[model samples]
Target chain A: MINTEPSRTRLPAVLATAKNSDGARDEPGEEIPQTISPIRTFLMGRSSGAGVDLLFYGVMVLCAVSIFVIVLAIIFVLFQNSALSRHQFGFTFFKGQDWDPVSGLFGAWPFIVGTLLSSLIALVIAVPLALGVAIFVTELCPKFLQGPISFLTELLAAIPSVVYGLWGIFVLVPLVRDHVGPFLLKYLGWTGLFGGLNIGVGLLTAGIILAIMILPVISSLTRDVMRAVPTSQREAVLALGATRWEMIRTGVLRNARIGIVGSIILGLGRALGETMAVTMLIGNRAEVPHSLFSPAHTLASVIANEFSEATGDLYLSSLIEIGLALFAVTIVVNAIARLLIWAVTRGAPARVA
Target chain B: MAIEPAGVSLPDNTPGPVPASEPKSTGPGRNRNVLRSVIDHSVTGLSILATVVVLAPLVAILGYLLFKGFSSLNFAFFTQAPRPVGEAGGGMANAIVGSGIVLAIASAIGIPVGIGAGVYLAEYGRNGVFANFVRFTADVLNGVPSIVMGIAAYSLIVVRQHHFSAMAGGIALAIMMVPTITRTTEEMLATVPGAVREAALGLGIPKWRTTISVALRTASPGIITGCMLAFSRVAGETAPLLFTAFGNQFWSVKLGQPIAALPLQIYIYAVSPYDEWHRLAWAGALVLIVLIMASVTLVRIFAGRGVLKGNS
Candidate 1:
């Protein structure tokens, strides 16, 4: 079947060449008899060049639609394999706290809560910093410094997540446990959120590392959005005798607010699904955290940490279900994000800048 | 002093010219303006500080990894499997070779199909309903967590085969690569001038031939870089391989057999309780970082030269 796809497209080109050969036979001194069969020539005549191109075009459309097929396959496999948990636990599977694999009890509540809380914390920490970086790079920094600084910021995204995990283990965890955690506990101890034992590796550490991991994505994307704002807007605001900040506030940022929000949501999507660094730093505890310093396990982290050790069919299915939930969350979040971005730039010329 | 108009307040300071204020009369208002300016300047300063603070980790990770891991990266580290537990001085040869093999298989699966889909998007299905669906699916696929992909691969390949294998691992990696390569290839192909297509079509060339031979050739460099970036990304992904490749202690090259990879080895070593393994993990990390950085740098160099023409 695959071989025929190419040959079908090739036949038209061959027929065109054969027609050219016939045309050559019509010229003076060209006495060669056409070797082409009449039936074959008739068939070729019936299928115009446009029809052959249309055939290939249809083939290419199938190729494009196959990408959608792959995505559906991913969703299908995840849902199909997790059927045991879906049947056994039902709705309670999402809400139950018990997750013992030995006794066959499984609950996704803690993992779900942990994933949300960590991603929330990551966004809280990342959004302000990323906005600042974007603002500075777009509106404040000297032209000479802008390119290098933006490049440096984006370099963070290129570093593998495992390397981030390594750095978290060696550098960030200790810094959090020794200093930042204790300080937050000491000062914000009145609030229950910060009132916990300051283990270096916990929800906060994971969240902070997630923030750092996603900083480049948010900042770069925001910069792209902010840069997309027409310069005329900035100049108009400035012409009204506004300060640089005021011009940026009233012009560039306001114009790009939807896109900026989309970028932040996109960052949130990434944080929700980040695995290696969060797994390494979150201490791999399957409990709902009482406070920022308490250890927790996100869905992605839990799956990464325990997929290999899960021996039973139910155990494996439960993990697959967690993956399904994670897949569902990220898909929903990213879809919304893309739509928000599309609203701002729809029908605009698609260009990298 | 000149009497002010009744109920008139002072005009707010603006960069444009304003009526001159009596110094003695507007002293308090002047103080408020000064404070506002001070706050604004400091806010800018803080934003700059925030940029620096966020950027520090990239430098720290690179510098620290180079400092800590560079020492352990000798000849032996590249040519041997990880030492068993406590006794020191081994390498990650199997994992390195396994990574190469897995990535090779992944590229083989991902590149042609991804570029074909991209060609469809750019050439045939531009703005069509099915094209939009494919584009959206690619976006969602890119955002799908690697661990979830691992789970999907586990269900799809491992369960059917009744065991983990390199083929499953490659499929997971290929799945991860597909969206990125497809999107970037579409972007690259979109950058190819329309005139090129018209030129090819005016010659009575089939649209498929024009897309494949003419347009694809023009966009090939960017697409190559996109595939490279995708390869570099999956090369360091550990989560998808956790259940798929499943790791090996010694050498294994069969496609159906389980294998080890650099990221998987690094994950195992980093999490293991032994100090020597941690040291080896550091070395492996340095090597992995180098591999990723090399590709990224190559992309950047190509990007700077306008080879991708900013379509990346």
Candidate 2:
């Protein structure tokens, strides 16, 4: 095969190198006159670098496949560690409501409800603002303001969750407890969502922080979705004598609505999985919060708050079970969001997601 | 019907070229125009308000951090060990050192593997089923949530060893970094024109060599940005380190032992009821945020310059 390379045979350097040592083949009619030199083979990777080529390709493929391996291993590890709870409670672990650690009765229903409630509140608060931000940045803002706003959005996304937690404790919890809670209680107390002791740290505060944390994610993806909307759509709407908002509503929003929903869903996944800030502000109670101000626990917050000190093997296993549930849920949510975003951005190769 | 001049209105909402059949002077038509313009202005106002509302928290967070962080960042804050409970005052020097170590280990393992995966996707596996599968799984891994990642590291390494180790924490962070870096690197490599790869191939370079020396070189800035983005993110994560690194009180850098981290330390401090620990928590958060913001800014600058250069 060394002398068989039609492309490299034309190169004088290759021809010269080929002549320096005999080919390795000893077939009856082959042109190889001598055995291959170990030094030449050592200096030049693989025979004609074919082995090296294969090696490089193999290494890269392995590296790429490592992602698959990591995910599978995580699933396996979660399942393996959570076996005690899996066998003990079986299906009832989900419906079990008593999370009293002292009694060792673990039910994920309250945490599930808490997580869903808080995340729903986050979506409610963030989606409209995120949509507005996306619209402003993409369609309404001055060209000069676009870059800074985008940068700021990225910065916001990069802000640490723990930092958000820190701020939540000192600033947001107090604000929510003192002013917002009281004001809402005074005016809209009949809604029942606001009915609580309102000591500040609760699901409502967690939801607010989560909303802030997720705002940039939704808005950024929404902006990308809108950007992927062809300019001709806008042009056609404007050519129809539509106002700017009318054009945006008819052309951009209509076209990118699925992707915008996908973006919101992605934000929801983030809000659901968000741990530190929620742990700090959600008051670390293992209860299904009836009101927004009531203390609550999320699957992730519970793991983060108690995983370090989960006393018994069963206790740890129960926590791992919650973690497994979180893992499964987030994976499903993210997969859905990715598919939806991909549907909208199919034509745009630059879609980062 | 009002004969108001449509030209008097803002050019944005003014009807461009009206058809003859659509009478502009009709009362309802003019009223509709007025209503449409009102809707336009209000939406515009609302969108701007949205921007302001979003910016308000960002400003408050940063501003508050600055105000509180500076006062708390004494000389001891950067150089001395944190004080024990019931002690007077101290700093988070151990955490700063510990963070550097963990992040270094994470980046070391993360960046190269991530870049390798990305290069494979960009250079070889364009539309292959396997490539798409890998990409999908990578994304799935990315969305697994940090707490789960913590749990994963705990079960995988901590349980096996029966103890916490910085190695486990580093591995957990590395795992988180991989998907982000891989995706970023892939996208950046994709942006490198086919012509460049073709040119390298035309010059008789090996496929692997061309991918490395040419395509990768061109995509370096974006790849760096991605790596930095991953770094900053994992650097600030606390949950994953809670049971992995396990947050040492005294300074420890051994791979098999628990180590302190800035975010983890900040977490421990933040939740503590002590006012002094709270101040230290603010200071730690300040440092973390500033570092993150600086890296993000640097990434934007580099990415912008690279993009402009590529276009030119």
Candidate 3:
């Protein structure tokens, strides 16, 4: 019914003719001419379309299979040896508050506590600092200073975590041990977190080191998200006589809240997975500390410290379990990040619409 | 006359005559405002202070290392092995060569797979469900602890081989390199416009040819930068190499034998009680910092140039 070129009609008509003739006649004489016809060629050509679909799906299936394989390999390898799975003390592995590998007793409480506590500390420190830096660079800073300031901030990200660890051991640990730790202990001794003897290597030092390591990640992400906020929002706030800080607080932060949260969580994830720096400065004690100033271990530090020495079934399995724990945590964090990004970007269409 | 709220304007005639008398009393208020502005500026200055606190330790460490490391940096330091515990002079030549060999091997193994996978993602993916899955897996892989990669490589390669080897070290480093390289490659490829791909296809080139010839050509600088970043990251990785490579003291070019690297050497020496060893550790740390800083700086410069060109 639709208008079309005669050349386009030729193929479909041939296909139709072939279909009709094949259905109506069975004679050998009729088959020969029909086989040689354009209609037969058209029918043969369309049959190969499924081949294209097969190739596309084939590659997709392979990728899917690989993902499943990786997950399975991790799970199977961790669980295949049952001796490693027996933390038989009934939730004691998580809550036992001690790790004496020398006595063959392994509890992850200190590591769990250290990892979570440090990451939390990092998030608390970095989120505000990052937001302030982002706001300053985006809005308050002079145009000439913006380039250098932003570049320096991002350059912090390029320094490897090992360098941070090395620096912490040499410089940060000494400074904390000599001046900061003693001062804090003298003033804030009532608080258990500051009550411990100055060992120079403790949860607080690890947290501070992590905070520095994660700062650039948080700031860079925050900057990107803040930059994406449309200029009109800022103009509207300024038109109402809002100061630069006030405008950023009301307009930019309000809009970038979800993105900023995502950025913070991303930094948190980095803090959690940090290995070398924490291991170097954390004193590597396996005891769950009653105070933040007490030496402790992290999951990453534990694996880094003991994976080589981890012989026998239980030791190896426990370490793999730790890896699984890390993997699960990372996946969960990324999922949260993805959800936050989706929530923020999803508002765009509604606003446009 | 009464005016509507939307149409209201300032009474210019009434305000102008009263301004001189009012302005005289506003001086004190202006000073108060100035004080408030100073407070605000100081708060902003405090934020910069926080940034400085975060950055200062890195600077101080570098300065200390540079100052101390310079006295030891000589031709002999580059070529000689460590002296005994109390001995005077030694170098990290073997460590440097081992690191170079491992990095070269890791790059050779990782770059092709990473680039090919990235090509598959950017060109053929089409934002399909499979692409999303690949992306998520890549994220997970990136998050996998470096030590875990070390463990995996140890189990899969070193244990089977029944001995530590540089090949095992290279494989472990390669695993670490893959996720980084893949992520960077995908990002770089994504930055290459679709129009370039289409243009190549329109000119009768096959999809594979178009991807390799045009898209990859455009993304090469970015790809190289990514590779360099991956190299910098893996070069300093000690945990993975600890068990697999199992540090060597003698000069070793053999892939099957254990090897020494700058990070492992630094770690071992730093932890040891010997004063001479500690000095070597400092020297190794200095070499490492220089290498990392240099590679990262180079990549940033190259990547920035690529981005500038892309924008233009």
Candidate 4:
């Protein structure tokens, strides 16, 4: 796997130089203290070599454990800061819909609903497209076309959310308003979901942008999972005189279902957590509506829109509470996604055997 | 098994043959085959259409930004603070500089700890409880909404310090960077051969020396690329900086002071009602997109060269 990069050679030399500098700190006369070949004891007892080893281990352990520490700290800090609202509203804070800053009233219901609906909409739109892309890449695409297409798909993920926001504002919104929204409403206007005013910046718009943003994530991840399905599995199915489509369905998609689900959940996590683009387009309204065209605010968008100007202690705490809720939702979703993917891959050999 | 021979059971859609079970019913059989082929080809065509639909936005965003944003990207745009509303000319120089400084601070704090954590995971963890816990927590942390991280930093650093500061913004970005860098570093280290470690140990090298010198050396390129990706990610983040850095109007380097950043600046400009501000926002978007796209391309090159493993 090692490809020779000229730069790789310089890294060890730099490390050696650093080690020499470290060695310079130890005088020759101090060698008497180190002559015992200090490599035997673990942590409590220390020889010189053991001391260095212990130091390294200690640092590594601390760093490793720091991840847990940071997560706990996030939970703790968010909960602690949101205490004011928790005390003020009790269980009603989440259920109440009003979010007036002037009256000093805040409720998370609309924002929570908005977040969920927008994310759900995004998932609905993105999943089929993502599946199609993934299938195309792993099963159908010609050999020469695969790499370029795959790269192009991933490039979608690399573009920042803010750029998406910019595009949503300048380009996508207008197209939706002028054409797509009218087209959908004309055919489906009897359905209240598509019947509402076409302001061009609302849950549907935000969701579509989110779908666009997350398509690459789902597609690429599913492609990875499907690629992991052994070639022998496909060959076996194909040898049955099954068509390419049927072979892919039975051999690849069936095997990678769990991983694909995980990929979808991962995309869901991203959609739920996406901020700048969603915030920019979701219209910053704090009220939930029946129609998809209504302007609404997600928990993240609310926090982004108001955290700076929120003056009252309760207002700030309420914003923090929304953040906490967003944090909790995304964490749970992502943890589940991670576990599923882990189970599929780490458990793969046993399944194959 | 139904034990039907392939020629009898499997439909022969090819022109040369018809199944014996068909009993010379050529018209219906051919029609069925044609319908099936049509469905198959249509499905494939639809998928190709999906790929195109997905790719169209990227092309449009770049094209629109280039067409609209290029004119505003001038020497003055890069050298001066944003102009007052209604005025035509100002650059995000302060925001650019602020982004650099904040990212520098974030990398300074995050990279070492992330790499160290990765070392522990690869060398000593090996599916241990603590390692699993760390890894799981990192995944969760990576998925935490960036805005929530902003809240966390606001409480931890800003509230404690009684003000928004560049330090808080940097810490917020650092928190975001840690999980990415740690995970990538762990994966890269896992790619290093165990034989290398054994050889180093056989030569009487200390375990720590072997890991830091040999294993880490081999994994450095991937780890560096990961860190770069993390940097690019944080550089474009706005929500985290919204309540943390709090945006400055002028150039300032002090860590404790409120600082401007490119993403935050773009957000402000984009949201502003003025047409001039929108123009500047377009320019900022273009610059930010170019920066991120370049970093991503670099990552692809690195991964293609096998410097990175399983991280497309």
Best candidate according to lDDT: 2
Model 2, range A1-353, lDDT digits (tens) per residue? 86668444344444444555454332334343244445445545633556677889999999998988999999999999999999999999999989988888989999999999999989999999999999988887766688899888777888899999999999999999999999999999988888969999998899999999999999999998988876667767777788888988998899999999999999999998999989999998988788989999999999998888889989999999999999999999998998999899998634321
> What's the candidate order when arranged by decreasing TM-score?
2, 4, 1, 3
Docking class of 4: acceptable
Clashing pairs in 2: none
Task: Please tell me the interface RMSD, in Å, for model 2.
Answer: 4.9
lDDT preference between candidates 1 and 3, better one: 1
**Residue A53 lDDT in candidate 3:** 46
Candidate 4 lDDT score at position B6: 30
**In candidate 2 chain A, where is summed lDDT lowest over 10 consecutive residues?**
A24-33
lDDT of 3 by residue, B1-312 (tens): 122111112111122122333356657765654554565567567667766665575577668889767765778768987666677887889999999988888888767666666766777774988777777776676776676666667766787899999999997787677667766778888988898888766755555556677888789888888888788878888878877887888888899999988888877776567767766777788888788889888788987887677555
lDDT of 1: 0.83
Candidate 1 residue-wise lDDT, A1-353, digit = tens: 99799667556555554667444333344333345645356545653468878887777677677778888888898888899989999989999998888899999999998999999999999999999999888777766688899889887887888888988998998999889888887888888898667779899999999999889889998887876666566667666656566767888789989999999999999999999989999988888788888898999998988888898889988888899988999999999888887776664334212
Task: For candidate 2, give the docking quality class from DockQ.
Answer: acceptable
Going through the candidates in order, their DockQ values are 0.36, 0.41, 0.14, 0.42
* Cα error of candidate 1 at position B100, Å: 0.7
Candidate lDDT values, in order: 0.83, 0.87, 0.72, 0.83
Global fold similarity of model 1 (TM-score): 0.87
State the fraction of real interface contacts model 3 keeps: 0.15
Kindly list the per-residue Cα lDDT of model 2 for residues B1-312, writing each as its tens digit: 021122112334545334442665867887777778789889989999999999999999989999999988888888888888878678899999989888888999999999999989988898899999999999898998999999999999999999998889999999999999999999999999899889777755677777887888888888988998898889899989999999888978798999999999999999999998999999999999887778777887988787676555
- Report the interface RMSD that candidate 3 achieves against the true structure, in angstroms: 7.6
TM-score of 4: 0.88
| Model 3 chain A lowest lDDT segment of ten | A26-35
Q: Candidate 3, residues A1-353: lDDT per residue as tens digits?
A: 45567546455555555667544543333223323455446445544445554564455345444543554554455444323544454356666665665666667777898899878877777777777777666666555667887777766776666666766877788988999888888888777668757789888899888988888888877776776666667667656644445556787789989988988888888888888888888888877777777888898888888877777666776776676677678768877876786667655533422
User: What are the candidates' interface root-mean-square deviations?
Assistant: 6.7, 4.9, 7.6, 4.8
Tens-place lDDT per residue, model 1, B1-312, is 021111011112233221243245557767755665676677689899998898788788889999989977889999888777777789999999999899889989888778878888887778988788888888888999988888888888998999999999998999899888888899999988999889877755667778888888788778888988898889889889989999998899999999999999898888888888888889999998888888777876775565544343
